[model samples]
Target: MKLLTIENLVRKFSLKVLTGENQLQQTITQSRSHRPGLEFVGHFDFFPTERVQILGRKEITYLHKLSIEERQIRIGNIVKYHPPCFIVTAGQEGLTYLTQYCVEEGIPLLCTNEPQTTSEFITKLDAYMIKTLAPEIAIHGVCVNVYGMGILLRGKSGVGKSETAHTLIGRGHRLVADDIVVLKKLSPRTILGTHDGKTKEFLALRSVGLLNVVRLYGRKAFQDETRIALDIELTKWQKNSLNNELEHEPTFTEYMDVQIPHIEIQLQPGRDVAGLIEAAANNWLLKQQGYSAAEEFMKRLESDSSW
Candidate 1:
């Protein structure tokens, strides 16, 4: 698991430290922050003690409405529980309510002004945390963009993955990554594939050595990332190679728990592997639009009277 510090958070959002300067190293374990309306009303049963707490205008007003004794007891319960930090949104009054409690209790106190609203600021924080806490892993493959469909090309070394990518680039396709692809789960069903920014500028080809793809094919020949829409596994041709029969059932491979459409293309002497990959991308896009060439062929075959 990745841990975030108040130090990083302050830098990310340009937050102002009202207190707890020495506690900048404090870690934030939860992706979401908390606002204390319920806690001000003395509700503490389900309070998330580890989440960063936020104080907006409404929350500060709520604390002021309570008698000082009641407010102290209510807010005191929350501070004693020891949350990661307390953030008072800019333009909110009543810092005394949280600042004193945070300072005395050793909790970090912070404020931000750029995004003034509590809603917008919290949303921004949530977006960053969601991405930072997301599951990620690196895999061996060549990723490319053909016909706007992101394709992940996989095969054993020397099986022509790079060579196929090279051909695709020549045919005006963008190469996302070569050799190493980083896969991140943006959501349950969305797997985003990205490449090293510097490394993506070059394509390593056997014997020919590393070719500068960006220079050779110009700027449009490369992309930093693409959503992995389909996967293609290339293999050396053999007598027992996968049959060319139409697949009525879909095939898939799991990456970050996302089931991406997958297909296997056998490599043969003088065969066009790049063209096949392009066709596979086109086929996948067509399937997404509810049109399948294989299904059409099957329907025609079944409609025929001849056995």
Candidate 2:
């Protein structure tokens, strides 16, 4: 979604302008080309140089106290500042200079009952801007929220990524994204996971055709978004001469500049893949809480030597 524009701001906050229609129109036309829907507040006029002249309550009062020519100079100086809008709080105080300048320049002036309310309104506007402006990236995998941790499953076409996700779903995990995972960088190190709008709930279940998970499992059984914490890869075992090591516990691997805590489970003839995945999720939880089974075993061995 695009961010709110000056017109949107006026409509949302219900602001009443005291000056500058011509200026407002010109500024809106020019800013729309760049910001599109950026919301503006208060009453202001647009200068020829594409700047807005704001007429605040204090300035209006000052204009009332000054001579006619002095008031014109004040409004001119304000236009030179090139503000996008002018805000006159509370009610009208007969600041004819400000009103005339706004009428001539066509800038928007906004009036509101309370300043604090306006502050909150602007805060929400900023939040909306950030969410809409964030960069988005897509990855080929299925993401699920299992026991409050984001788990991403990746492998070859027939390597059972969706099947594993289904298994996890059946085991009471919440599905986030099915086939294509949309990842957004929320922070420097944190990546938030979501699905593209087109495929948010659509999942391919081999023989079952397309299935709507939300329709089947209810909304609570799935999350609209989550932060990706780990990645699991499934690979077919090759009986070649290489590093052959017995699987002791879960391990990790990295990909695409992300330290995706990974585990390559070799799919064999008679392995309980679903159960293994559950155990992997539990192991990840333990690791996150600083409990390592390998480290515990080493500690036990050292203690036994003293005995």
**Model 2, range 125-205, lDDT digits (tens) per residue?**
444444444556788888888878888888888787787777777888888898899876645566678888888877788
Of the candidates shown, which would achieve the greatest lDDT relative to the real structure? 1
Backbone clashes (count) for model 2:
31
Note the Cα lDDT for every prediction shown: 0.84, 0.64
Every model's TM-score:
0.79, 0.62
Candidate 1 C-alpha error for residue 268, in Å: 3.3
Question: Candidate 1 — which pairs collide?
Answer: none
Candidate 1 Cα misplacement greater than 4 A, ranges: 64-67, 90-94, 146-149, 170-173, 196-202, 211-224, 239-242, 297-307
Query: In terms of TM-score, how similar is model 2 to the real structure?
Result: 0.62
